[model samples]
Target chain A: MTAGVPVEPGTVRIAVDLLGGDGAPAVVVDGALRAFGADPDLHLLLVGPPEAADELLGVVHPADRERISVRPVQRGVAMTDDPRRLSRADTTVRAAVAAVVDRTADAVVSAGATGATVTAAVLGFGRWPDVRRPALIATMPALAGPVVLLDVGGSFEARPGTLARHAVLGAAYATVVHGVAHPRVGLLSVGTEAGKGDRARRAADPVLTLAPLPPGAHYVGLVEGYDITSGDRADVIVTDGFTGNILLKGIEGAYAMAGGPPASGGAPRAAALLGVAGTVVVCHGAARDDDLASGIALAAHLYRRGATAAISGLLADHARDGHLTGPGTAADGPGRTDHGADERTEETP
Target chain B: MTAGVPVEPGTVRIAVDLLGGDGAPAVVVDGALRAFGADPDLHLLLVGPPEAADELLGVVHPADRERISVRPVQRGVAMTDDPRRLSRADTTVRAAVAAVVDRTADAVVSAGATGATVTAAVLGFGRWPDVRRPALIATMPALAGPVVLLDVGGSFEARPGTLARHAVLGAAYATVVHGVAHPRVGLLSVGTEAGKGDRARRAADPVLTLAPLPPGAHYVGLVEGYDITSGDRADVIVTDGFTGNILLKGIEGAYAMAGGPPASGGAPRAAALLGVAGTVVVCHGAARDDDLASGIALAAHLYRRGATAAISGLLADHARDGHLTGPGTAADGPGRTDHGADERTEETP
Candidate 1:
């Protein structure tokens, strides 16, 4: 690595899973080069087959190549493969997670099968204390600023408790990462009115209002799809993974259909994985080179800012006061333990 | 109302809710006037408080006033009003539905509360035999052509049978209205691969595959949000009401954010309410003058083409045979009534 001037003392290292994504090695190679070229104090741990790493090594200059370390692994989790296969020992994704667990890298970045990355992260980096479901947070560049949308493609959750926890995670992220002052948080639904959605949204509405928010954040009631684009109503928009995932993809598709995104910005293809005890950014499965570079940049930014520790610390403090506590327990929702439809009996009637 | 030509033999009469939407009376009046101006032989039964219709009557030429009839209902259905109130005769929406049932109007158009419109339509026209849940179908301008998405905001149904019935309705509508050579129908889910979604989608997947389709349609397995905008994969995209409604709004919001829609067209705010015996178009609750006008135009087009009757006739023919003998029905599991999640217990595991 080129030892740069002492701007930030510690160099942040990111483990890039080269085998992930539809484009695989070619796009991944191009993205890694771009990310490395942009960040002077950044280092990359290439985790995949040696040949894939060599492909990147062949192109980059010898001076920058020192920053790149290769962790050789062969197998990859396919799009159609079982999500649990990320747990397999020789798989590149699992190896990449192992590198982070072993302190070889400060953060992880992948464009692999989302379920696979999520599983690997959950299994590798221990879940945050009292945080059951680790969420995938995507920040879209809106007219006003970056609008933080969470649970875009993590665990599928519908319980009021999970929603409440995700709201807290989102609020903390907005304040710590985006530096928003008194971030306004909103729950995503069809209509802005309190009772304008289906049964799950109806149950979650009052619960969100009643729950305590992180310092400098307040619940702004329900927000419609427009707020996600305008970023006028709320800084943080929270929803179930199922809805968020589809909404994110829908917006992306819309931008494509419209020829391009607005002059302000467009829907994001990369999302930061929160709730795990590490910094990770997951890119779209069909991401382009730039999207992967964005994912890499996000991972580096999170690592530099110590976002994981700060947000986790915020949650720990919030939990100690028993503020904004969910149903059953703090460790009872999407990330922490396995809960099915039966657990929602209290809110479902 | 500008009657430029003599009324045709099969002139379709549409009841226009003149006091609906945010910019009521003004926008609705303008929309009704525009729709009349556009369609030479169309007839309009204006349903609202007399003041709204009076505003329209003052502007129209004397000879064209005969083409416009007013039903002086005192109250319009407020957006915040309970949907159950739609059954009351005093409401304009209910009276509008009554016009259709009374054979005064061939169809109805409203930019009011979706729940109210659905409730009034179900009460007045009655759902088609065996149709427990009606769907809202919207045609999106896609790259390939029109991509028909259903259950935009009709009823929140997660049942497999409801989805299956929606498939039949969508296939029939695509063939009769859109006139695709061989419509390819897809079930909207998280992934194209089998077993790639939540419980509801998983349950609906096989049921949709096994269920009978209407003429000139083939099941193309699972589709994602992108398919709705791109239309490269399927002509008809199907999903639960909750998901479809949110996706439609999300796309609409994106187009608005991007300044405008693509050259082809933008997301539609107007959707056709299917499963009711009569033809009805529901615009967004926050619809502007142009949106209201577009809804009216869609209604007139549907009425002129006899699309409702043709689709209904196709379904009737299937009913007569006691089974849908369409393209994809004879390939898989047993066909059954009742589309709830309970039906999938036997098929899944």
Candidate 2:
């Protein structure tokens, strides 16, 4: 849209939910200020009550005031609010997504209720052409390199078709976002043996083996939980959100128990929401100031790379020819059939 | 019946699966010898090929050879063998369970496929009257005593009745095995907040809250992944096998990534097979020498305390008073139906 201006190369705009997460505006404000000071070109669209926004505006220097903006929402989707309450427009997360949809910001970030953010994004930016369930992908810094874990807390479907689709999304994301060459993908299971794992994992195994992957990604059969940290067996680990979310949190807890994370970095506190039309990052619900800053930086990084549009374009191109389903499997029901299809996308190039 | 003698008080007999795990026979023999030497009164029933059992026999002194018995099963199950092959009698794990059933061995331990060991125990020792899917329970050594995790890799069904049954088993096991004065049971979810998990979890939560726990156990609603490692929220955390399996392995992987395990201990590699009428323990499929030894020791510990029989009695007494569900409920379809018929017990106390 900016004609090769690279969207927000030097200037990155991140819309943050002021009243999101367990700590809310207090911690959110602290994190926004920290992120603002760390990145000279970083701008924030604080989305919450005016009082909360004023707290951050009062702290930042007048010189950096130009980099800060506010889109004050009257209220936030309370943590205790019913999932149906997400339809309300006055919610902070909904307003934050509006900033992105309106092109007032480059990306959106929140540590609020995952369901609300997902609902808002799906409603605001609209699902990608074929993505039924928008996935929350987290990249953990493993022993070898970055390991891309998808569906951290998005869809919870265990259908073989859903898993196979995630494998494609994961592979493409690794290549486009992480710059990995020929990412080896593995299905998380109890054992490495072919027939191991629950019903869904077993059914998905054969499908993935036969289902051709995007360029620079190959199926490496079954892998175990160790692969998430070791990064020895595969670069991309695909799992349903239920398992991924539990695994992610378990790893975080383990790091806490073991004094601290490894020198190679601990479990990521932030995750990028993939499959949505906009770039969104989500930190833990109990995020600290440092965690929030990391989320901000991740949003900045995703914005700088134009990851949303680029990945969307790649998917679009791939889906235009309907090649996303690979060779000869064209009869597969609606691209997002079996899974929850929250981030439905087309089988395009 | 152990001759009504104390069995030397610490005199424990464990059936070690010599042909189990990735590095079997050699590693199993080495691990058994280490466990034997570590515990002076420990006895072993080494099950596998004659040559594998002979490997251990050649090392120990002739006077102590009586502590070591051999059950020669020539055929060994490969890692890739079909899960149905678990019913085969020639496998070492089956032989180990047979030794326990025949009263030659006190308990069975194997680092073989979980399906194989589970099936062997079910067929040999019979199922607990009230349980359908025998839950695999593992105790993690946490800073705060021990955290008991159930259905780590047993049945993967997510039905509410299964979860409730597993809760009873977990709580009873916590009291009988871990000796916790009063175990606090919890449902594992993404957050401690109510209604925070997938449909299966949400459906199981209320059922667990109202389900009749053992005499000294109480349900503490839901706990997060952090609770699993910190042991701050509950003593016994229960979930479907699929999630529990991944979470357990993920913790193990995280600890490995953190250089080593914490000061207390690491993720448990051995899981005590509960729900079966006899004491059985399953080690990691990729177990090492030390891990295999730990599994053997765990089985011996269970047998020594009469853990299986005691836990079974607890469930049986509770079921007789119109507390537990029927066989149909215990093995009901997915979705965890909270409202179910209170029928007669399938397995008698």
DockQ of 2: 0.41
Across all candidates, the chain A TM-score values are 0.91, 0.90
Per-residue error at B203 for model 1, in Å? 1.3
Where model 2 places Cα greater than 4 Å from the true spot, the runs are A1-9, A325-349, B1-8, B330-349
For candidate 1, give the docking quality class from DockQ.
acceptable
True-vs-predicted CA distance for residue B226, candidate 2, Å: 1.3
Can you write out model 1's per-residue Cα lDDT over A1-349, one digit (the tens) per residue?
Answer: 0011123436889899999899997898889888888777889999998999999999888988889999998888788775445467777777888899999998898888877787788889988875677788988778888789977878666666788889999999988988897999999877786676666676678888888888889999988777888899999998877778888888989998998888777788888888888888888888788888888888888778889999988888898887844446533334321113421100000
Choose the strongest candidate by TM-score.
2
For residue A49, give model 2's deviation from the true position in Å. Answer: 0.5
Q: What is the lDDT of residue A16 in candidate 2?
A: 95
Candidate 1: residue pairs that collide = A132-A335, A132-A336, A133-A334, A133-A335, A133-A336, B161-B339
TM-scores for all predictions: 0.91, 0.92
Best by DockQ: 2
